[model samples]
Target: MLAPESTRALFTGHSLGGTLSPMLALTLAGLGALKGEGLVYITVGASPGNKGFANIFAQTFPTSTSTCPETGYAVWSKNIINSRDIIPQAWCMKRILSPAQNVKNIPSIYGVPTIPFIEFVVFWLNANANKSHIMYAPLPITSCWASSLRRPLKTWLSFWVSHWGITMHFITMCWV
Candidate 1:
């Protein structure tokens, strides 16, 4: 149960848990356990739901600039996606095939060779598994490329420090 003085509830999860967090928030809001305006959810590497579910979620918890009644902070939900991570691309046919389709385009940091046959196999498998009729839509997202994070670490730290008062060490440790 939320304390009377608590004006916000932040729900967060990674990977599969990320997929469930938004659903959990929606369920709780529907059950009247939490107010939509007082809840915020942040998911990392979350899989996509069907288009209908995404639409309902967007409508139920629309991002707003309005501040919470009890707290001055803005009421919003954010999906954080690591651009290099494949898990976040699941259930969406185009996104699922993107890695294979663009394998040659991505720079290889480790000098790993890109095999054409393997790319084709991956594309074939994903194309067969994810059909066209079933559409999946992602929520509004804050995208960051994992490989490029180190270059922007200072800027990232400053943003987090200013907004959430988080320590640089904590943010660095989490990323590492």
Candidate 2:
């Protein structure tokens, strides 16, 4: 829908979209209808896995035969990530880029206030001996979940108490 003359620019999805926007720009150039100039991509809470895909995708674009116009194209890719957000903070795009590429990391605070809950989920499962090694048991698939729901209250209490002190600080970050 982006005609060369009529099209101003484009945008993509939240996390996955950030990684794919650059590739879309390259495709536009290959079609001969769009130049690389004035392309902009902004990703929030983006995933690091995209870095590997983007590096390989850019190489496939027509680099030799059709160089980006000398009009000084502006390909602005901005990634705004919350410090507590585990997904985007995990990977480094700079490590993947070759010497020729320039990518800057800008730190920002945005989105909801929430602790890293995954850690607690893991803790609860591990502390309960009955719950631990859940995969080892071969109970009827339907019965497994039903049995878990009926686990003794003491087991649940012990699991929470064991990790409560340790995870308190982790949970506070969600509020602070």
Against the hidden reference, what TM-scores do the models get? 0.56, 0.33
lDDT leader: 1
lDDT (tens digit, per residue) of candidate 2 on 1-176:
44656555654445667545655655666566564343434344243334444444434332221153332222234343333333343233242332222111112112223224433443343344223232121000000011122333444356458868755664454344
Model 1, residue 34: distance off in Å is 1.7
Model 2 alpha-carbon drift over 4 Å, by segment: 45-75, 93-176
Candidate 1 segments whose C-alpha is farther than 4 A from its true place: 1-7, 64-76, 95-114, 131-133, 147-176
Task: Please give the range of 10 consecutive residues that has the lowest summed lDDT in model 1.
Answer: 101-110
Give the distance in Å from residue 64's predicted Cα in candidate 1 to where it truly belongs: 5.4
User: lDDT of all predictions, in order shown?
Assistant: 0.53, 0.37
Candidate 1 similarity to native, TM-score: 0.56
